[model samples]
Target: MANSRVFLAGLCLVLSAAILVYPSRAVTAAPNSAQPKLVDKDAQESIDKGLKYLANTQRPDGQWYPSGSYGTYPTVMTSLAGLALMAGGSTPESGPYAKNVRRAMHYILRVAEAEKDGLIAGA
Candidate 1:
């Protein structure tokens, strides 16, 4: 309740500020202003490369093998790797790394199914 109240108060303040600035008028884009590109070609290529790397490195069981300091945390690595792939637009049902995503989900589900409380954690 307290959190909601604070959020509402902040939202009201922001809305009031916007009203004061615009005064019920519709805003328009400036003429001749070029539309900003969301991502540059170089940045997009880097993202693609990174996504491919993640997909390639992911094990067939949906787990990522960690090394050195992270070696013991295969669960964490798998979850994070899955999330990164999702962020890069892959889902278990579709997208470039769909098989990997599906395998990851199955791996997590298999672990959770074996646990008493359905928690996905280290064995």
Candidate 2:
């Protein structure tokens, strides 16, 4: 019985490691949220352009805060930008600004995950 427990523990460890090293489906999977459903072409274009502007304004190190900025304004700006894109029904897989949105989503996810201890930020 003790040996069985050890073997199971080892197997579990290996499986957990594999899961961590493997790419997360969250990064590639379609969002399940009905709130982010796709929109018309023109609307999508607008969302894409807006996201483009936000991404273009980001710092080279992938941040919305300017150097020597005060308060959480940077965080707030980034958060708002992400929310706007999400509200416009954008995703990394299928959206008007899929690439830029994905990049922005990734940045916000990192911050949210680090601060909130969860991946429930952009989605």
Using TM-score, give the best candidate's number: 1
Instruction: Indicate the worst ten consecutive residues by lDDT in candidate 2.
Output: 114-123
| Cα lDDT of model 2 by residue, 28-84, tens digit | 667687556558789878867876777677664345764554544555565566456
Tens-digit per-residue lDDT, 1-123, candidate 1: 444544553444335434433454356555464888668999999999998998899887778888777347777777778777767776666678878877776665555556665544564
Give the best candidate by lDDT: 1
The segments of candidate 1 whose C-alpha lies over 4 angstroms from its true place after superposition are 1-35
Per-prediction TM-score to the true structure, in the order listed? 0.65, 0.40
